[model samples]
Target chain A: MKIIITVVGNDKVGIVAAVSQKLSELQVNIIDMSQTLMHGSFTMMLMGELNAEADFASIKKELSTVGEQIGVSIHVENQELFDAMQNI
Target chain B: METKQIRDTIAMIDEQHLDIRTITMGISLLDCIDSDSHKACEKIYDKITRCAENLVPVAEELENEYGVPIVNKRITVTPISLIAAAATDTDSYVEYAVTMERAAASLGVDLIGGFSALVQKGYQSGDRKLIASIPDALMATSRVCSSVNVGSTKTGINMDAVAEVGEMVKALADKSPLKCMNFVAFANAVEDNPFMAGGFHGVGEADCVINVGISGPGVVKRALEKVRGKSFDIVSETIKKTAFKVTRIGQLIGTQASERLNVPFGIVDLSLAPTPAPGDSVAEILEEIGLESVGAPGTTAGLAMLNDAVKKGGIMACEHVGGLSGAFIPVSEDAGMIKAAENGNLNIEKLEAMTAVCSVGLDMIAVPGKTTASTISAILADEAAIGVINNKTTAIRVIPVPGKDVGEEIDFGGLFGRAPIMRVNQSSPAAFIGRGGHIPAPIHSFKN
Candidate 1:
């Protein structure tokens, strides 16, 4: 299963390190990634794949906690959610 | 996907109350009919439970998977009158409603509709029985919702049923007025409406199908805010664009749900339904179009424009669009509407005019407990005339809160919301309503 992880907040050190480390710990593999200072806020988009049996809800909960620890907001959703809305 | 678009979607869901309001499974019960009432009741219960067993679980999984809130998982079946026709031994169909309620409870569905009869032109024996049983059925079950088609553009209005329903509604007030909330009298009621208390699986529909209703008045309002002080053109366009995005989400969810349930996908109802929640309100969208409050001057015109723009915007987003696909203005279910009614800015007269331009008519309104049955029937007649003449759908779900006068309110809690007892027209329509017969369908002439 594919997922999209979005992180947005004021710029700070080790934001990517904390997020990626947490994703790796949860057995999520980062297949693609991008980042930018969008609208004066540090924003990152990470596309990842999860195991077939992995739970997205618990993974999302853990990722958000990691984001809170780093003073940022994180949202994780099935990639299909974005595709369904944006593509057509 | 572009990061900007992704961000906008996230903000819409998180802050703007964008969500798929309901994913209703329409299950036809024609084959479940039996000569024996007990056997028929068993078939009704069995088919509903079997078909919708996975509805709540699948919907919950989808919600967690996509992170989009699917607020309700509901079922609409073939109208009980049609299904109960084979059971001639029974005079009341309350057991049918009880069977549906039991199925809903076991399946964990939020609501079950189609405890209804369509008597627009005339009544069948079963239709009369089902209509007679509606009040007791409503009092007997919590999740069961009932609707009766009393008029249509093609068939005209059934004034006899109208008069009877008025007395029936008054009777409901005598015991538990809240049960009145479960019933709707519709004009030109659609076959595939996914909203309660009017949703029923029309005989024309498939054996089983999935239909979704989308709601996001907050999203449209927020979009309009970005184009504030602009002309009606910009306001209309903004609402259309926002409605398109909101409906796309509905289409996606409906498609996925149908595929997973192994049921054919029906249509996405493009109605911008609202809740009592602070930001999610269709009335607020009208207010954003520049009304101080709902029912103020220009409210009906504003609603007309909004309703048109929503259809224009959402028509292309789904495989098919049906149901009551206009902006809904149910008073008890909308925040801005409730405030307006409480503050004297909104009244039943203005609401009646507004219904001409919107989807349902005189919905979720609470009238003074002393309001007469003839007057209630008169309200139904007025709305039926509007629908029949203009070729639109209108429905009435009024509650005559017992012992409550114009200044009082009924807090139904949750999505049922709270409704202020608005004043009703005191002039007795007893003479007119007392004279019961069919109102002939109007001529579609160029003489207008």
Candidate 2:
């Protein structure tokens, strides 16, 4: 299923590198990506499709752990939720 | 759309109090009936546990996947009165309530509703027994919520049942005022209401279905903040836009749960139900609408606009919209309402006026232990009269705190929230209540 991985935190170098490395390691296919910086804070939205055998909860926990170590907050959610709310 | 939708949803959950309030699985227990109450209870237990076994875990999965909080996972069953009517020997529905509680505990569901009876017109066979048993049944079970439908728009007000409910609520309060939170008296109560202390799976509903209720008063209030000082048209339009987004999320969750659980999707109850947290209050939304305070003179007008906008927005977002879908003004459950009540700014009469525009009537209000039973019945009659004439759903959940008087507060804690005992006009309604029978349906009810 498609998912959106959002990373929001104070702007810093290597934030994208850290996230991309984690996703590549987990074999998640990043379909699209967007990033913006405002008021010294960074917001990145990554659209990805998980493999058939992917475990979203564990992947989310792992990514969030990386975010914690790097002083950021990461949210992983099914893209359908956003589609339902905003694209309805 | 430039990721704004994703960002907006994330902010709503993180900052605003957006949530799927309850995913209630409504199960029909009509087939659980048996001549013996024990057998009936056993069947009821099996049916509920089997139907709701995955309710909690499934909701958790949805919460995790969607990155939103599902605050409650509830179950509603056919009114126990109907289920136990075949058990003519059952004097009290306490055993049935106990069974419901056990099933709820076993399934890990938050609360089990449908410990109820529909006596809108008059009492049926098991109706009086169930009504008599409510105090005992509620006190006897931990997670069993109870309600009675005393009147309807078509059936008029059942003054007899309304009077009895007043005594029942007092009796429940006498045992433990906290249990009063589990009971509600209704006028024109719907069958698919997924809310607590009032939800019952109607006979017309399918065997099993998924009904969802949404909460986002904070988000709505935040939206209104942007439109502050704007014209009323802009204010209403902004609210509709926010409500549409909120109810659409509810629709997705309901549909997903139904597909996963193999249950039919019933409806999305689009209510701005508030929590005790400061930011998440329907009253705050009204205050945001420019009311000095919730019980202020212009409050009803504000609530009417909100109620209408929510329904209008929600109707387009989902196929079916039922349940008590409006802005809830429960005194205790809402942070803004609690503050207003504690300061003696919000009175019971004003709340009654507000109820005509909102869904629940005098909800989560606490009165002095000395308040007479007839007074509570009179309050119910007034609210019922509003519902009957206006052709809407109105419910009352009042707690007469034992050994407490006005101004003192009772902390129910958790989702039930807290309430400062509000003064009830002590003039006795005994003569009016004593003239019990039926208050005929309003003239508009004769549309046929």
Candidate 3:
């Protein structure tokens, strides 16, 4: 299954690096990435292909921990939700 | 993969309360009927538990898998009256309700509906028995919701049944006003409704089906805010676009849940169901459409536009749309409506008028305990007239809180919310309600 991880908070160095490292460690492959700075607040969206054996709950918890350490808010959601709401 | 679309979807879920309101499994209990009441009750329990064992888990899995919250997992069965009719030994159908409550509790479902009877024209023996047992049944069971269809477009209104249910509602409240919250009286009740306390598996439905009800009052309100001060055309267009997105999500979730449960997918009820939570209110949506408040003048016109636009936008998004497919105005369940009522801007009379243009009528309203059954019957008659003449679905789920007066409030907690006991007109309608006969179908019902 694919999931979208959105990060939004104050702009800081290595925001993408921190999030990407956490995903890689969990064996989740990055499929797409987008980053923008809006009024000095950093926003990034990462699409990742989750491994079959990975624990979704643990991965989400670990990502939130990483996000907290880096001063950002992280949200993980299935891509189908966005596709369903927008494509139709 | 567009950033804008992703952000929009996220905002809808995270900020606006876009949610699949309920995923109700309708299970027909015709085959469970037996001559012996005890055996019938056993079969009923077995059938419900066996069919709905996986409903909660499956709904939760879908909620996690699709990243959209499914607020309620519920069950609706063939109206217990039909099943109880076969049991010659029983004078009451309270056992049927008890068995349903057990099944619901065992399955971890939020509520189980269809403890109901349809007597739009007149009552049968079974309907009479079921109606007689409602007060006790509802008072005894926590999760078993009940409804009675006392009127319809083709058959007119069953004034006798309406009168009985009005007294039944009072009796229910006298036992426990909260129990009245679980009961509804409907005009033109739909068979596949996923919303409660009015959902039931109609006699015409399949043995088992899955129906989805979607909710997004917050999304519509937010969209209307964006078009603030715009013309009606822009406002309507914005609402339609937002409703399309909400219904599409409902369809997606419904299809996925049906496939997982291996149940036939029924209709998607595209209702903007509201909660007491901030920002998730149908009244707020109405206010956003240029009304000063939900019950203020021009509210009916605003609601009519919203109801029509939602149907227009949602019809294309799903294969089938049924249930009460419009904006619901349940006062206690909506923060804005509750506030409007508290501030004296919204009253029972205005709400009765609003029902002609909205989805349901006098929903989740609270009246003083001193209110008489005849007055309640009069209210039902008025609402039923609106639905019957207009050929729409209208219902009443008013609670007459026992020992509570006009200024007092009843806190049902959770999604049932808190209700301020609004004053009812003291004028007696005893003579009108006591004339118990069928209100004949309207002239417009001759569509042929």
How does candidate 1 fare on TM-score?
A: 0.97
Best by DockQ: 2
Greater-TM-score candidate between 1 and 2: 2
User: Distance (Å) between predicted and true CA of B117, model 1?
Assistant: 0.4
lDDT of 1 by residue, A1-88 (tens): 9999999999988999999999989999999889999879999999899999998889999999998888999999888888877776
**Per-prediction DockQ, in order?**
0.67, 0.84, 0.69
| Local lDDT at B436 for model 3 | 96
lDDT of 2 by residue, B1-448 (tens): 3577788899899999899999999999999999999999999989998988888988999999998899999999999888888896768889999999999999888888999999999888999999999888888888999999999989899999989999988888889999999999999999999999899999999999999999999999999999989999999999899999999999999999998888999999999999999899998998999988898889989999998998888889998999999999899999899999988789999999989988878799999999889998999999988998899998899999989998699999888788999988977899999989999988888886
TM-score of each: 0.97, 0.99, 0.97
- When sorted by TM-score, best at the front, the candidate numbers are 2, 3, 1
Where does candidate 2 stray beyond 4 Å? none
For residues B271-334, write the lDDT of model 1, one tens digit per residue: 9999999999988888887889988999999999999999998998888999999999989999
Candidate 3 at residue B213, lDDT? 98
When just chain B is superposed on the true chain B, each candidate scores a TM-score of: 0.98, 0.99, 0.99
DockQ, 0 to 1 scale, candidate 1: 0.67
Global lDDT of each candidate? 0.92, 0.91, 0.91
In candidate 1, which residue pairs clash?
A: none
